[model samples]
Target chain A: MNHKELIADIAGKIDLTKTEVEHLLDIIVDVCCEQLEGRGSIGMQSFGVFDVKKREERLTVHPTTQKRMMIPPKLTVNFKQSSILKDKLKNVPS
Target chain B: MNHKELIADIAGKIDLTKTEVEHLLDIIVDVCCEQLEGRGSIGMQSFGVFDVKKREERLTVHPTTQKRMMIPPKLTVNFKQSSILKDKLKNVPS
Candidate 1:
């Protein structure tokens, strides 16, 4: 489902107004982004752990030209599913 | 960070009471689990998508005895981070 649909579902399930749910969702997204941008990680149980990983600069060969190229250091976000969530999903029917 | 610490952080950031944050977190976890168990996915923008994936049963060799064994079908939860979040993380300093 998309964002609107997901928010609707959350509101229905929680008996909250759509506006309130949307506001809260926005806050959650903002908080997560801010945390990762500052500390490189946000740990939440049952949901998952979001972390930033860095790849150092490296020399790589160009496949076609056979020339060496320097790849710049980069950062990436990684998500590790929580074991509790994993176990729950494992039993879910397809 | 652990669950409690994470909740505390969320509460502090949002200016919500710890108890309220904990309660909402619990509800979120319950809703996600219930949705996955009924269907197979929960899609949330800005956060990520949580979906159940099935691994079909297969025959595998036992390394020690070299005997064929049947591997049962398995389900797993997969998370695909959103591009927006990925970009934010990529710019984060390590």
Candidate 2:
């Protein structure tokens, strides 16, 4: 599902208009980004946590060219699902 | 930040009340979980993608006990940040 489909799904599930839902999502993203940008994590109960972690600078060889290169350290966003969600997903048909 | 703090932040940013923001978050979680449970993925523009991936059953030995055990195959939720988010995260002080 894409953004529009997700907004429609949430809007249908509650007493909110599509525009309102979209706005809510936009703000949610903004808030989460702000938190992550500051090296903070967002933990939503029964959902998951979003965090920012730094990757150390490292040397690597290019796969095709087999050339050595230096990769600069950078921050990354990561998400880990809550245990409640994990339990719910345990029985998903493989 | 926990769920309530996040809701507060979002409410402060938008015109919505705290209760409404919380309800919206609940519904959003429900919808996302439903999509993931069905082995589907959710893609939000400028945010990130939530995906469900299956892990093949495997065998591993306990670290201390050194006893081998079988690990059942299960579904897991994974998130990958969008390039826009990644770009924003790049300059984060490491």
Candidate 3:
């Protein structure tokens, strides 16, 4: 669902107004971005863990040129879903 | 960080009490789990999209036995990060 619909769902579940839920969701996104940019992690129970991982510099071939190029080290965010959530998804009917 | 600390972070940014934030978080987790179990998707802007994918049933050899076995169809959840969030992560200092 889109942001507005999702916020409405959250508002219904949490007994909060749509505006309040949207504000909270925005805060969540903002904080998560800030934390990951700072190389930190955020764990939400029954959801997943969001963390940053740093990859080492390496050499890789340029796909089009087929020539070796230096790939610089960089950080990336990874998500590991909770086992409970994973199981629930696995059993979902198609 | 763990669940409690993450909730605190969210509460700090949203100006909500810890209890209220915790309740809201719980609702989010519950709804997400329910949605995925129903083979639905939830997209949280700046965070990521959570959705279920169904894999076709197939025949595969057992890892140790090397005997052919039929693998049943199953569902899985996938997350795709937003490009803006991905770039923020890629530029994080190591």
Task: Please tell me how candidate 2 rates in CAPRI terms.
Answer: high
Query: For candidate 3, lDDT tens digit of each residue in A1-94?
Result: 7677788888887667998888888887898888888888888888888888777899999999999999888776777788878777665556
Better of 2 and 3 by lDDT: 2
Worst 10 residues of 1 chain A by lDDT: A85-94
In CAPRI terms, model 1 is classed as: acceptable
Q: What is the DockQ of each candidate?
A: 0.48, 0.87, 0.63
Interface Cα RMSD in Å, per prediction: 2.6, 0.8, 2.0
- Say which docking band candidate 3 falls in: medium
Backbone clash pairs for candidate 1 read none
lDDT for each candidate structure: 0.74, 0.91, 0.81
- Give the higher-DockQ candidate: 2 or 3: 2
Model 2, span B1-94: residue lDDT tens:
9999999999999887999888888889999999999999999988999999888999999999999999999888999999999998987878
Per-residue lDDT tens digits for candidate 3, residues B18-71, read: 998898888978877887787778888877787777778999999899999998
Q: Model 1 Cα displacement at A66 (Å)? A: 9.6
- Report lDDT (Cα) of residue B77, candidate 3: 72
Cα TM-score of candidate 2: 0.95
| Chain A TM-score, structure 2 | 0.93
**lDDT (10s digit) by residue, model 2, range A1-94:** 9999999998898887999889889889999988998999999989999999888999999999999999999998889999999999986777
